[model samples]
Target: MLKDDQFWISDDKAKLDMSVIKGYLARSYWAGQRLEEIIERSVQNSLCYGIYRAEGQVGFARVVTDDATIYYLCDVFIDEEFRGMGLGKKLVQYITQSERFRNIPGMLGTRDAHELYEQFEFRRDGDILMRRRPDHMRS
Candidate 1:
């Protein structure tokens, strides 16, 4: 959990507003074609963080991990209206600094947002990130 004034980020799945999450991802360039069921299942299986303001959920992030060794950060987003408020940075900070994630190697792939992730020390290496999704899964 993390708080700043009226905004906060929480790992509690119960705090997640699925409509807000699905609505955002439904229009996102990366996940626009994803079905709600897939999103729900992904959320259910990962450690998710929801960023909220007084009104409701405004951002989200998730980490796929085994609670040890490796972790992958994905599906991070802050509502358009909420961007540029530094909430995104706070979300990254909260996740990377949390006791449970300390010292664990984390990975993420992004065509954009490299500068933001770099602030948390995420970097590009010579090795490529490979995937084996079905042909239909390619976006």
Candidate 2:
């Protein structure tokens, strides 16, 4: 858990405002076309963090980890209305500093926000990130 005057972040998935998460990701380049069931299933399976203000959830991040070795960070976002207030930095800082993940190697894919992630020591590995989508995902 992390908190300040106006925002708080937690690892409790039950506390997540799924509507807020779904709404944001529904329009995101990476997840915009994802189905609600897929979103819910992903959140259920991953270690999730939700950032909130007085009103409601405003940011989110999820990590897929084995509790040792590797950690894949994904779905990171701070609401457009909530950006520029350092909340994104705070969210990443909290995750990177967490004892559970600090020593583990991490990976992520982003077409933007490289600078934001670089601040936390995340760098591009030589190999490109790739995926093999399921048959249902074939165009």
The top-ranked prediction according to TM-score is 2
lDDT of 2 by residue, 50-84 (tens): 99988989999999989776788899999999899
lDDT of 1: 0.83
Cα error, candidate 2, residue 86 (Å): 0.6
Give the alpha-carbon lDDT of every model. 0.83, 0.84
Report the C-alpha displacement of residue 73, candidate 1, in angstroms: 0.4
Q: Give the TM-score of candidate 1.
A: 0.88
Error of 1 at 38 (Å): 0.2
Candidate 2: which pairs clash? Answer: none
Q: Clash number for every model? A: 0, 0
